[model samples]
Target: MASFPTETHRFQSFDGVELAWTEMGPGNEGARPVVLIHGYFSTAEVNWIKYGHAAKLATKGLRVIMPDLRGHGQSAKPHDPASYPRDVLMQDGLALIAHLGLADYDLGGYSLGARTIVRMLANGAAPRRVVLAGMGLDGLTHTQGRGRYFHRVLTNLGSFERGTPEWLTEAFLKTTKGDPEALLRILDTFVDTPRDAIAAIAQPTLVVSGVEDFDNGQAHEVADLIPNGTYREIPGNHMSAVTRPELGDAIADFLAA
Candidate 1:
């Protein structure tokens, strides 16, 4: 029945951009923490906290470090497209780990956050474990259609009629209070870890997907990329699955293993 209080902190990223982090769990100095990266247009609150992901991890005596990726939450939202360098999100996570002086940890993310984790591994990170949710093998290549859809929504925000995909997505983005222009740039600069690189990450991994969400391609294929990886399916689609206790539980169980 124990619960940890939320503590927020800001650390300067390598690029000098200050990013925000929400830390939870007993602040045990020796505990190897878990870093939860959120999807695009998502904050620490949405992707981790509100959905009870952090809480579940906290109850297991695991520290949860949830950072609001720059341009998404309370982090700096530079409106200029050119300001977001390629691999900036991955850089933020790596910078945070270094700033905390963590020698070992588990890392995971959903959607865009998962893609960043892949890049982190491709860049030589060797986390104790990784949870890749709402992403698939197709993540290793261009998500052109996905990017184009978000682009169209951002550029033609008001043009879509109610109940349409663009309209609904715009509404969701507004709910997160993310800057459309900043998010557009995020999409602009997003890229995948090369196929060869993804296949080479040998760390233990869990690839979780919703029963109805296969938009990113084959989940099994993504799992196959990791020599020690496995895949699991939960109840909902990309967005709805975030709130399911199953999602959090699955991640917790994997990291604990």
Candidate 2:
């Protein structure tokens, strides 16, 4: 539960849309840089900073870069359909790396953020190391399944019953103060990444997920897809896993190794 100092900055993405990103850990030039993207419907604060993951990574002498993905946090949330083209999140991530002039760095993300990492890799964004947390082969290959589920959740926000998966997602969305219209557009931005592209990823990758998190399919199967991928399981389900210190520990260990 330790709190770490963080700095927030904004930059224009590929489409001139202003996006916000936060930085934590050592500021010195020698500190290794790692870009950590948050999950869908969650901001950098809720996903990384709020749960002490950023702090944990920072303590290990890493410069953690966490971006509040478009339509999620402090970034621009345009409801216009045109604002969210296919694979927009991946483009924004690539743009962020270019804007920062990161020639060599690491990348990590959870859930939707993990999906974004896969998209970035497929689209030729090369980071030295990568961590795809809370994702699986099915999640990457069957993007429409999860997208359709989220689309339903957003379109019928108040109709879900208590304790249901949709209700939990909606509750989390409410807590994040997410814009439904904008998020619906984000859902439209998703496109399936072929298994061959995933198989071609050459970076050392870690496929870590919660033991109970089957929401995105089997994590080990994702590890099997990548050319140089490893699988690790942490405590908690999809919703609770990110909050656990083991998640940060696993990521830091992998990155440090």
Candidate 3:
């Protein structure tokens, strides 16, 4: 089973929100740290540990850190939309790096976490390398964001009506604690990016997506947005992409490279 070097610590953001984290691997590794950011609505322990991937990376001699984003895991949940703004999340992450005294590191995130990493790069945080999985270029589409998207996802409160596709319910159930209304508002507020903003990212990015994933296309789109980047596809959809070992191997290999 995959596992990570485990030690828990806390850091306070600029606004006094206490952020919780699990640091993995040997802190003595000469290489830069590898920070793992979990998807929105998911906590680091549930997403990384449950899959056994954390241990795999730890054994590879990479320093790893997984933080519970505000409102998820052990982190404080402000429940205020302003507190979770895209820019604010990026700033909090930078604060975490500074707190650890890491001058540079490899960055990795899944789904919402991945999206946040992208925004962080655009905002000028320089991680030596980046791994963006489960998010792609197509960004969220109106078709997916309307009707079922809003009801089934944004406002979905646990469990997918049984007998309905298990995947549908599971994904929705995973994201329930996140304020749907707040999410929608943020989406509306940050909808468009200036063409210049898209061109701002210069990081060497590894764009990863599952061949059967909903955001595969978007993952490609996100890659195109970066000046120096590459894309690779693995088997499975969003959830399976994270749980499967092959995916972790691919990520570990890419970051090590």
Span of ten consecutive residues with least summed lDDT in model 1? 136-145
Per residue, candidate 1 scores C-alpha lDDT tens digits across 25-96 of 878876669999998778999999887888888888898999999898989898876669888887888899
lDDT of 2 by residue, 118-220 (tens): 9999998999999999997889999988888988899897999999999999999999999999999998899899989999999999999999999888999
Sorted on TM-score, best first, the list reads: 2, 1, 3
The window of 10 residues in a row where model 2 has the poorest summed lDDT is: 1-10
lDDT by residue (1-257, candidate 3, tens digit) is: 44445888998997788999998786675845888889755778876766766766777778778998766678776656666564566777788888888877888888767766766766667888888888765443222332234455555455556555544545544554554454544343233234456557667888888888874246677677678878888888876787788777877788767
Candidate 3 yields a Cα-based lDDT of: 0.70
Q: Which is better, 1 or 2, measured by TM-score?
A: 2
Model 2 residue 180 distance off true place after TM-score fit, in angstroms: 0.3
Tell me, by TM-score, which candidate is best: 2
**Model 2 ranges with Cα > 4 A deviation:** 1-3
lDDT order, best first, reads 2, 1, 3
Q: What C-alpha lDDT, on a 0 to 100 scale, does residue 220 get in candidate 1?
A: 75
**Alpha-carbon local distance difference test for all models:** 0.85, 0.93, 0.70
Query: Considering lDDT, which of the candidate structures 1 and 2 is the better prediction for this target?
Result: 2
TM-score to true structure, per model? 0.96, 0.97, 0.82
Query: Residue 125, candidate 1: how far off, in angstroms?
Result: 1.4
Candidate number achieving the greatest lDDT relative to the actual structure? 2
